[model samples]
Target: MASRDDALRALEDRDWSGAEVDTSPSRPAMVVQSIRLPEDLARWVEDEAARQGTNPSVVIRGLVERAARPAGRTDVVTVRRTELELALHQAVERAIEPAA
Candidate 1:
């Protein structure tokens, strides 16, 4: 059995008091390369980040993840222009309709 002082010294060396090792993929410290986007796209990314209440990098990461995901497994669906217009019309009609 180890002495109490030795155990205390080991605990002091470990130092697990509220400090995280930060192994998460979303943490900025994990990135090794820097990327520069075109001005227009960068502005759009910032604007979208503001609208979504998150950092621009997070928005960009989400977009990259979405693009990399397997087809037909996404939460968002792509549609034809006519189908989008029809859906928009239906949504507007529903919004204008009075509650029952």
Candidate 2:
């Protein structure tokens, strides 16, 4: 992206040029770890990701998020993409709209 995109390149160059910096982060910092899943579970995750029209990482994240929430919590969680935002919403809607 830095090689092909000027805006990204400018940011990558890190010549802040007097831009204000906000050191505070609103959410937990990202942590990367690798896990090994059994073949059957792996297939299920891949299938769910395909059904949701998202990558496996997103499906896994949503599952983890739901599991981490406390029981009886009524909060709704929506998984979305910054790029192709509308497309993602439509795909998700198609999965439940008929019953909903």
Tell me, by lDDT, which candidate is best.
Answer: 2
Clashing pairs in 1: none
Tens digits of per-residue lDDT for model 2, 1-49:
3455887777788967889989999777888767799999999999988
Weakest lDDT window of 10 consecutive positions for candidate 2 = 75-84
Please, what is the whole-model Cα lDDT of each candidate in the order they appear?
A: 0.79, 0.80
Stretches > 4 Å off in candidate 2 = 1-17, 24-27, 76-100
Q: Find the candidate with the highest TM-score and give its number.
A: 2
Count backbone clashes in candidate 2: 0
**Residue range 7-80, candidate 1, lDDT tens digits:** 99998998588887877686346564567989999999999877655688878887887889988884765667
In model 2, state the lDDT of residue 76: 59
